[model samples]
Target: MSRLTELLSRIKAKDPKIGNELAKEIKVLSARRQFGLNFERHKPENVELANREVRRGDKIRVLPQRGSTKNSDKRLWQVKDTFKKKNDHLATIELLGHDVAETQVVKVEDLIVVAEFQDSIYPGLISTGKVEKGKDKPYNTVINGENYHALKALTFTHKGKIDAIYIDPPYNTGAKDWKYNNDYVESDDHYRHSKWLAFMERRLVFAKKLLNPSCSVLIVTIDEKEINRLGLLLEQSFPEAQIQMISSVINPKGTGRALFSRTDEYIYYVFIGSAKVPDKVGKGEEKEVRWRYLRRTDDESARGTKKGGPAQFYPIYVNKNTHKIEVIGEPLKPEDDISKIKNINGCVAVFPIREKDEHHMNWGLTKPSLEKALSKGFVRVSRKEDSQIQPYVFSYLTAPNIKKIDNGILYKKGQREDGSWIVVDPSGKSSRPTTNWNEKSHEAGAYGTSLLKALIGKRKFPFPKSLYAVEDALRIVVGENKEAKVLDFFSGSGTTAHAVMRLNRQDNGERQCISITNNEVSADEQKALIKKGFRAGDPEWEKWGICDYITKPRIEAAITGVTPQGKPIEGEYKFNDEFPISDGFNENAEFFTLSYHTPLAVNHNLAFKQIAPLLWMKAGSRGKRIQELPERGWEVADSYALLVDLDKSSEFIKPVKASKSITMVFIVTNDDRRFQAIVRQLPESVEPVRLYESYLKNFQFTIE
Candidate 1:
């Protein structure tokens, strides 16, 4: 036993009551000291709350004086009164939490609101702008706020639903790249690593909650500075997760150093539950036979009319006895009834109708393309024992499969009697991925910095992630899902969302992404702003922040396929899914700023507009979000049904039950029994959620 344990035992014998309180402290201390990878776990991380007017009883911190290099006063104070003094706005404040008789007058612009750990904050989101390039696609969200509080708000909307989380947090290189508790943790700080650990641990704790417990993965990228400590923290935070680290060479020409030149960074993948690494055929890696379902599942799979339809929306005649695709039919016209299509010569005419009937989805290949692929022995068909609507399932070799064969990547094992080829992938020969990942596309300087420059036309941010590197990492986890929900809380420069957009364009997938970042100005820019007359929360100063000037602009440019100057992007994306950057992407994204609200406003239902978007996100983010409260008792969107007035439950029930696609039903009622009764009357397929209970109770029980 350690000293604390032995001391606790002795103290308990002397004084039971005193020992009990001491034990609590000892337990906390022991948790930090006894661990192999220990740090100051309880260190509180404070956030400089922004964009709020100073009010009575509000906590505030005095901003450092202009031309001053350091913050001299770190005390927290409460606002007592505010009044205009001549041409200046001044506030009367006293030191918070202490019985002080003294009060001081300070310029309002010189003070900023502050929130400490465990402070109850009512978080809301206000839309800054939106970039819409497609309909029937979920909106990718970008939130500008401190990630910790943002993650807290996400718990209500995305808890246990995120498929993959990719974060590239500050490396804590002591270059003043990151801040802790409103102060930059420079190299000389004695508790630098400790503070970094505390910061990471708090966010990781919330990250674990946001991930899907059944199958999801967390991907974190860092350099040598904190890789080891990060690994230990990941293990400690997610003891049940399967954690592995990969060394990836990002820069071929290493950074100059006193001893060894650093050339690579590490990526940690923490797999929870049934999540597993993907099997992929690549150069210098094992290759294997791969056959994917021919039916498409993404939003682009929907059936279209002849005037504007997918050419892949044709039929295949499959012989029932031989289970062989015999003939490929021509593309369907708008007037051609699918029911009128008949079997040909003892064969079944199979269209790409989906199972469980989500939509009349299109096939992955067009009629002519399917015919060519089939002649090359790259197609096969099978049927389940009791499959209906979709009587037969078709499988085919994809582009990667054909490319491997043509490039001699996979060796042919043998040939089957039915004119099919057997192939084996030589790389790894196992589903598990290798620990070392070195690829040309993973080069940050080329694909990351250079590609971003080509798109946005400037290096507005530092050390942004390589677009391909993030795409490959996410592909390993949720690529097959197609409609995966990905989150990146530390979304610097918006690379993660850009990667997701690229991935979707590659396969016509509908994967949605949510990225969060703070609008922090660089140290140099901060000094320059302070030299002027601007303070921290001033609009003039915040306009130059990373989110406003870089992240938001970068994401908008990527989605719209244009630069900030409205010129078409002039480069082509490289590797696996290559496309001209000018082609743009069929996607939509909304930029939001995290807004704090008063508890009184939220409880009184005065913040419905602010809360509506979150409710849309909770209901799978499908279809257009309802921004306003409906005057009618109920409103039914494409994917979700909302009942604002409880008295109209009877009118709401019929339409909600009639709609086959609605997945979420939100009822506005405070009565538990009434909510349960209404829920019981709804369809089993619909997830019934109580509006106030789901939203308010979660915040009231907010974890610090």
Candidate 2:
């Protein structure tokens, strides 16, 4: 059969729905030949060796170090001159020893060379808190870079250190909210998917390398829009890993729309290797009840039956000292003619017994243990009569431990009487937790609904997770180690951090949290700015721009222990910016000054040294002067040139008089007709001035 026919037959036999979908997609793809669907692989450049043969001292320069601009430009010239002059001096000294009558000498091969790798490494360590007495505490460090770059650096050293990772990356919804290479990529872009895919693929590859063998990653996402695609990505990236889905019901109240309410979000659980749930014992375990108690009305009535008159007629004696009921010997048996039983409220049938069988007693202690009754001066004895005797029965209330009561039935209204909150007794026995979950029960206090309210507060981070929910999840993963490092890169409003703080305070566990959040400003700030009568691009209020209103304020709020509105709150954290540098240079040459007017080469170096100074000579400054050369004497009139020969050789005599001179000019204003006239009137013998554009612009010069 043909390939098309075979494919059609297989599609018809397997899945009609998927086959139809694939057919439609194929048709669409055929119509759009230039849809730009393609696959590409990225490989790092390899260090090449001569003749493909390895040799000693053949070091590969994978990544070059960044140098500082503090004194970099000054040192650059110094280094070039030093190496070149040293070679010249050595050749000159050697030439002087010779008996040759040559007036001047030159070394053909001597030239200044710049070292390929002449830069410094940035040596900055980020610390989360204070250290003391030889103890090293792990600090939460923030890395700022493009996704792949940051991931690569982190993976280089942090492999096998992370226990859990949570990421909430860009959703790629086509809005200008997402940025790639410092510019926002619009939704309608042709290669949107490819761009996002490439971005995520690089980071995910490195992120996988950073995870420990048993570590897990939880990715929060919405719908199945990218689920299948992400699943395929994960399969290719981590072939041995397994992917599971956890759905959380976020919204229950519908918007009363035409379709079903969008209430749930999914979390993709990706485990690097074998994943195990941590063991956790819920709180208030000591107060929980194991079993319940029921009244013994049937046993009470049976014991009363042995009495001659009525079962309820038996008298139960109470011990005043111990508050325990005292059990006496068997009661006297009634005669057959005198056994006229009366049915009372607590009465039952009577038992007949012979008086001579008093020594052979069958009744045992009812309320107390056998040993306890004996120790309390009780003996087994039977009352005797000529006809029959009735046995005495004692009544006692058997209660169970109140703490051990199950939360199932007791959670309902009116389970117990008004005076009794619990049906079971409270005699020292504790209870175990039940499978039934009660939101309002005492056992639920550790993970109560109240915790959810505290975390979210007034700032509604949509679908904010309940604190109890997170704590319960952590308990399963943390096990007995109270110092587990938890990371939540998608931390919205710092809920996870709050939960960690609360858990530590309650359990005294020293759990640490690393939370990351984009500095998106809240809605309230936009409203407040409009209300404050601010307009866009107003010079007086230009600093209050959109970017400033958003990222800066939100981060400040998080670090300063203040609400989005700047209200003070307890438990503030000190935050500092962490700048990471490439690991290829020495410490001194990693920072440089940045500017637009400077050459791109200089600016690239400036990124390493942010505060390096720039040296500029203003035009018309007083300095060394050169005598005017005749215009007719110049070989090139339009272009100016000068040569300096320090040896003053007789073999190379200059045709014109040479003098050391430096030219400079400064424009006072753009429309300075006087300066233009002066330039035109300059003698033809003078060299044409080479003015710096920046200096001219700085003086506000205009061509007249």
Candidate 3:
């Protein structure tokens, strides 16, 4: 039977009407453009790799085509020629879709042929962060690239290796906080949520491939704006995994500012395989802390000196010379004639300021209580103005003090002592975190914002995740995986990296964290640059991006034990319960920018030097040899080797087989027949990976 007849017969068996309609559609398209079916192999929609070879008439798609850009707009090219010239490592392609016959030499990594093996690996990971010369970097990685493409590249490098993925994506609140494609996805745009989900779906699909199927975690954080949709998305994506949500309070006191205040956010986690979630038990919260109220409240009105409590209200005397409490005076107990009782001699009396009448309210302490507080060094006083001083109560101003609890829930073991607030249960014990988190450490204002500002000297990025929060999250989910591979694609302000460093310092665990963020400039900043005759991809535009300006620098500071201003971090960072956090968990991490390299020569010809770094990264970036040794016949280390010269294959295979250290071998040859023959002869212990087959097949669009 004819090809058309055979195709129609097969289609008719499935659906007669659809087959008839498809036949017509094929006829019309056949007349307009020729597509090579010979080189195409039948593939399922779920398959990620295309066919292994390119044919004369195969359709090709150019990726990353910016809609309004001059280049990349012309798509749907066709292959006019497919032949190996100098080597099989690369094949040449002549485009029939465009007015060119192999004029623009293409990268096999750049183009995707229709109905072909869908696999595409990116080029070398260009080093972006500063690394010490001659140092072998086998630690974490931070990638500044578009996430979808980055995730796809990771599939080639990190397949089945990732242990954790924690992403805090844009909430899609129509706040223009994120950009989709080249445009800012705003709230007014219809289908904004759909666009966000679609964008997430594509990346998530590849993210799953990078994760260890047997044991891994996929965590996504969102606010009320997208929690429901994200929850559904997580369910659809990870159907077999156990999914759970943890509501964490971030801004609890949205009380008077807004209705139904957004005090909390959600963390949706999907644990796959044997992945386990352990409660954080040894955290400093278990270390007993003296929780104290800085202000004294009258029991009747539940206000500080609001009305009526007399005996407990009195002034404490401060020495004007030393700014220290010198005397505790008696109170005017509603019956004490003020003229009869002399004020404490040689001291100035300071009274507590009531909110309703702060200037006139009496101080909140009996003479005995004040005396005890002074002895315990718990009585703190602050004066703001320089010349004429007026002292205000300074409770809860430091870690030693706590929030006054008259209007709030008094925490476990929370109570008033002789004069200061202290936990009733002085013994510290680890407690499981509840759904409602009002801990002082959880408060973003103090721990997240202020702490970051103190460390960095400026708050360049808004709403950074608290370092403690991320640390605790990892501690809970990661459990005892000492060298866990943690991934955070949305690495805002590098908090995850900071937490990883901190966690490693605490446990001496060599956990590696990969942080990826697109170096996209803010919308307003981009617009301003555009007004100044600047456009995207410009130097100025990159300077405004969150990744380059905030995340990268912040991460560098955190790892190098320096402040963002380049100052060495000094002194200890201690929690309220006296848990001393390491000031500088000094560690090393390599930063990479996702980039593409054009093919210098064709016939599936990849420049071996250019593709070397990519191969090394695929081997977990753990190779001890950063460079090829002089006079060496092959490129190698313990974990992996890239064979550039086939002549040395016999010599290379001998050592690899004997040592049993090398597991992945890459031989650079385009001859599939030769490759297979060599593979059959190889030791069963090592896996044979082709050097540039998919890459060579990808960039073809030749027309016969």
Candidate 4:
């Protein structure tokens, strides 16, 4: 038997519970190898946290004793307890507040992992790559790093604030396409699925935290390879969410394969809390009822709904001999009796067919409705299939029917007795989209590839996502909130970012997108690159990674309206023809690489400086600087202020209070006692936000 078959059989032969344990063993080892366990002090840095190891060692600030405070963060540093390991928690010599270092041991809670951006790589937003900023709109952010830690960090600033989470994770196809810990999980591997699941599960747990559980949509796209598995995972992970599946046609010409040609992919919609899947309005064609609800089937939202359309409650006259609706009557008032209403044309009054025998009470329109529908060629006269009943009136929202409906207007408007009602126009009216999708814009080559190539030059990433597809999915969830915050953890070639930019440009919305991707080259591929005279950790090696060389550059190009070669682009608009064909979108974006500062001990002062970029991002990249701190203390801005020193805390507080525009102040202090003290002293108008320490506890893992 084949090795895979044998492995499958062996696994199936064992109890699923036992096999599950086996998978856990691999997971534990994977976690240990991917992120080293903190052994200096065996108290376990992330023992209580999920998917975290140790945080930044540099953000530790030494506390100078003015007087004794209530919250000294004794948990971070203290006299070495003979009963406990001394090495487990200890700050660097620079962080020592006391002259004597023998008794000082840093508190476990105080040793945080701070994410310091590589200044040489990021250096802040690119001058020319800035998307045009409108008042109060947040800037888009693209993070080039491991998404797991990125998501954990987001839980600090964006927890419970995100409106949508769209992800297209690795498909885990055995083609060595994706990596786990630095090693690619090739197709021949027996545990490929297990590793991918472990990778996804931990990140998803953190992602769930970033979402606004009360009103948010979780959208996931995948193909046949792992669609079923992903669906089950989403269901299990988000049990409270309403799960829905959509089959989207990506390839009109099926991908010819051994079994069959695969023509479609799927999108899973997990509507959490008050979130909903809205109705999609299509081009106004009356005859084509492919996906839309026709026949005025549901009494709700129908034409004559209660007080919805009082004037559209009239009857359409039907002739018996010809089965034609030759005349339409005036609508009756809501107060008029249905039994008393009659057709003035000496024909049967046909209200929008409601219940059997043409329930007249629920007709969708009045005389004007009939006249308009007739003019638009929407009304039809026919009987149900295989029936000898009298013909009825049919009105469609779109084009005429493409296929036969059991209760449809009969194709054969057969011979009728004298005075029969009859009416017919070209029977085609179109409405909105349905679950079964067939659209050309969704075609990858039409928009996905051609558009991405125009922005990035060559096909940097294979089978990139279509911009229209992502935008359409996002548009439905935003409802009225145009400036929604969107998170795309697996933002392949930055299609989601491109889509957000296009949407903002079209509607002048202020939506912001946070894209996180790992810029890691697999170990197996490093050997190959080395033969090409390049080594890992070098600029050339980074070019092989997706996040840095492809995703970030693509984002820059898309936002700056330039090609990857830095040339201005001029082409036809892919989705909208009315919009001018232009170079890249004029949207602004910032790129950041994930790097952590792991000092021997904490450096609170240095951390204060490093956290400015993060603060800028959290405040929607408000102004360049709110209050400029000449040396220490805080700087104030319209959206937020940064406070560090107790001496100038009052200086920070005064202007912040008078501004009336600032909503948050980032308090930078290692001592919990001081942190609480500052919180107590801050004005009620502004909320105190702590950085690095809390977030470090969640994302301490390093990407090797």
Candidate 5:
């Protein structure tokens, strides 16, 4: 048996569950070993004494520190008794005015510090890059030397800052598309999911700190394959967030000669808190039918009273001279004039009008309501001058015009006589969107498939979401709030960015997007870039050097807002670089320097002594004299002081009481012991002094 097989057998003998769980891993590793494929595994050389030595029954805390400079050589410092050593690998440290648990382990060669305390507090950081400001620039300004992988470095700087996060990481199917160290994980690898999970877990821990209370994360996934597992993982990572499912039926496939075609993909929507919920609209069935009036005809006569017309009654008007019936109001328009008025006909029907005194009601309206209608000119009355007894007069009540309309058939589909499909205009005398998705007849076009076919035609990516679908989803989530920021780390063909730009143009919004992707290019990718004129060694070409390809053409496409087909839209794109602080400092100072300070206001007695001479040089060259110490204040001996008593001396020293000359001194020290010693030596008579430490160190200091 191979060495790996033997190791697995031993593990199985000890713990059957662990052995069974890790069996697949052993087989894959063994296969790779036999095939001579290169797979790199990074292990910490130093054993991370703080994490590996946890003592039995000891509870410890883990705080991770990242992006330290290589040359700093600064060892992790620990205060002896303040924190008890729980184990050879663990220590309980006090932080944030409380004792907390910290773990010190080297996960993938990254530095972590573990402390033990009572409460659970995850130490994560934010990414310190230049944030985009206004319309003048299309992209954010990324400060040089910011490490992209070091999440802990960003916590203090980026806490509660991110509005949204979208990431598309490697699928880790072991198709030579992902790396274990610098090498790829080929197909049949057993630890594929484990590696992917670890990668995501580290980033997610940091990502949590970056979110605002109302922030949300959108993770795009395919099929039932890993979505459930991913959901579980997310639950573990962000216990405070609520998980929502948004299943987009992007592509319905018609496959079986015997079975129904398959269509649809799912998107997982996870939100931070109560602030997140899926957008929904009301849905129900119609229960009642009602009629509304359209127009009124003349009250002069009720037509269609002839023999051929359906049986109907017409109120007759008596003439004093002839006692004949006549139409009252002006004749109806040609279109409105009906050939005949009928009662109970198969095709048309009419109802008779009754007087208030008649006591019989034929319509739904009340007698008082009808009277009010007559008062408002809705009903009409006619009178004849020559009419005999009872003053020949006629009153006619209008019909409650009925029109046959579709009942609950709100949505429609299919193309019209013309080749184009029919679209329901929400405001154009049509129904609004309803919650019953099955009722929606509109397909949103053939592009509804979750795996959007590449715009350039062939499939360059395994699963690219349709731009329209993303926009639709965004419309439901963001609605009219157009200025929201969007992030998508797994930016394949840059569809999310494209969708954001398109949505912005359509709505005239100022929405911005940030996309993070690896430079690992696949076989399909190289062909795509080659078509775009990307060549090796070009300045514009280096953008594509990372695991996620970034070429000049890709960026140009984003800026011009064009698809692979070359259609122009309104958008802007720019490039930026993220680096770590170590990149800014020289090698010697990179690791050792914990913080830096920029000069703000400097008091003579509190400023760095070494810097004082530089300030003095600048002040003296300008012909201004340094002031002397004030009266009634304690002073340092032999140091130049800013004095209020200018008349007493031109010398650096001033006589306070003969032989006891007083001067002002600015002391600068980084050593805690030295700083304390200087403070104790100051005379009791001296007033309290103001001291300014390095701004970087000051920022890192916790009062407690």
Candidate 6:
């Protein structure tokens, strides 16, 4: 009769063990509903501190031995002491399990320190190398480190500034493609989906902060493996943004064990704030351009001498053999004789005359304007069949057609031999892209893998996205923004950077891309290294990581027009734009490895050298970074200024106003009133940022 008895009666009807001996001790418990995605939210994520040195009290784990069994030590340890023993560095460590005091000494080279997400870290960037084709261009950056830490650091440098974020994260194919808690999430792992979602959710939270608040986009590419789940995850993660999923056929030949061959993947575009698709044609959506005669033929008054202006009565000359619009002559007076005007080198002169009445019709544009149109290839010559006075007719683009070309509604295919422009109306190109896409260039095998192989000379990465696929995604979102700042935290093989360069080359844009990826070696390589008595942090082992082996080299090859081996790249890039790879791109790029620092060192203002790049990036990555502190307590670069001394505000404010290009001033002081007072003295165009406090608050590990 009680609630517990009522619950017991329901269970008794469905269970054979209801009245059994084991069921006698069973107690009724309340049930809670899990309506949506549920995962182990408290599960700790370990980040291996390969670049940091081993110190006392640091958490550590021993590298797997080659001949070790499955029962190898997976427990965590704390370093009690570190010392040199007989020419080898050793560390005394104690077990961090079940209050155990078991202690052991191991070679420091054989150990890797791991940091949990909850642990506080002061992150900095160390420049490893750079490739510059010109001095004026901003460097496209590539960071070799764990992406989570990179994104955490980006929250300070790039928050609310990125115009586009294109990421091709691991699809969690359950084939050891991704890792969770330092181990691969194999197909048999029961919590692989939950772990993948948790992993993505943490990074997406940071990604949302890095995107521009007023206008930006987040593009994620995924296949059937977790498309539906990823869709839901994105919706939950970006609740305030507009999200749309597009089905793109990356592989025409399906690869799957199911009845239906899986040939396509999906792309999620999260348009935030005022972001919208540009009015430009996408791939395979071009229409032929239709030309109209320049003469005003609709109204009779427009053709008469009374209404037509004197300057509009001009003659457009055409080559007799080529039929191309060669020259545009001065306008003749209404009383002047047409027969007296001399011909030019056998070229036929055609005037805007009515074919039916022999009345002088004015041109749509004046003589000077017609000459400018001829230079742009907007003027064309057509053969007239019925006209007596003139055997040829002059045709030109209407005002609306010219407006379309200027607005990017029409695409210029190329110029004709006659120096005329060939424009095509990309039908629906300026409209929103459809949900489904099937294009040959989007084929991964043909364009993605093969193209990368051609660029880097081998298949080092597993599966890179088709360069055109990334290019289209970026062009659709940031096409109108010529100087967009793009970021890709999961930029494996550096495809996003390559795509950014391709887009820049297409329109002479200045879009800078920041790519972040870790230097993780492949599974097979890891096995070989362990057999050779080499651990992860060793130079020999770390050199084979995805960043060093494939990403950096591929990006360098793409920019240098030569492969890693100094050989010229072998093929031509084909798609929306075509060019020989050997020509390379007139762009610059810099490579940096994410480094960790002690909070004490950063708090004392000793980490300025390491944090200089972040300031440059925050200033839109405009010019060379100011790598050192100035004696005057202030320094100005091409795009930003830094004021390290509060007393030097009077001097700093003068140069900043004179340097019209400087847009950001980082005043390094903790006093808000002083900072605000200094900001008021500066030009309205310049943004004042408080350093130290602003920088330290971002690294407090708030998001994780």
Top-TM-score structure, candidate number: 1
Error of 1 at 384 (Å): 34
Q: Compared with the true structure, what per-residue lDDT tens digits does model 3 show for residues 379-457?
A: 5554433222235333332322333233232233433332333532233345555544455556666667766665666
Q: Candidate 6: give its CA RMSD in angstroms.
A: 15.0
lDDT of 6 by residue, 1-704 (tens): 38656676777777655343224443211221255454555365888887788888888888666434343356789999999978999999998855547989899877778887867777889998888874597889999988988988888888888999999999998776778877888988888888898899889988988899898999999988889888888887787889999999987888775678889988999999999866555556886576665665434434435667678877778888887877778888877888888789978888866543455667778877778777777877657554465677566766788898889888788876666677887664535567898988898888888888987886578988898888888888887788999999998899899999999987889989999999988888877777787766779988899998888988998988878877766555775765446557889998989888776677677988888888888887777578998998999999999998889889888899999789898988878999999999989999888888888787875433
lDDT score for residue 413 of model 6: 86
Candidate number with the higher TM-score (2 or 5): 5
Angstrom error of the Cα, residue 555, model 6: value is 1.5
- Cα lDDT of model 1 by residue, 1-704, tens digit: 58777887898999886697677656666567455687875547778876877777788888778767665477889899999989999999998656656679999988888877767777889899999875888889999999998998999899999999999998998897999877888999989998999899889989999999999999999988898899999988999999999999999899976689988999999999999887655556644465766766544445883433668778888777877778898888645688777658888788876543335667878788788888988876666445456677777878887898889777667766545677777765445578988889999999888888987886567877789999988889988989999999998899999999988987889999999999888999888887785766788989888888888988888887778887766655777654446557889999999888777777667987888878888888777677787899789988898888888999989999999889998888778998988999999999998877778777775333
lDDT of 2 by residue, 640-677 (tens): 22222212212112322232332222222233454455
Task: Report, for every candidate in turn, its global Cα lDDT versus the true structure.
Answer: 0.82, 0.34, 0.60, 0.60, 0.37, 0.80
Model 3 vs. true fold: TM: 0.61
What's every prediction's RMSD, in angstroms?
A: 10.5, 33.1, 14.7, 20.2, 26.0, 15.0
Worst 10 residues of 3 by lDDT: 37-46
Total colliding residue pairs, candidate 6:
4
> Least lDDT summed over 10 consecutive residues: which range in candidate 6?
24-33
> Where is model 2 poorest over a 10-residue stretch in terms of lDDT?
581-590
Candidate number with the higher lDDT (4 or 6): 6
Best by lDDT: 1
Q: lDDT of model 3 at residue 414? A: 38
Query: Which ranges of candidate 1 are over 4 A from the true structure?
Result: 1-25, 32-35, 64-72, 83-90, 97-99, 282-432, 702-704
TM-score, every prediction = 0.77, 0.37, 0.61, 0.60, 0.39, 0.75
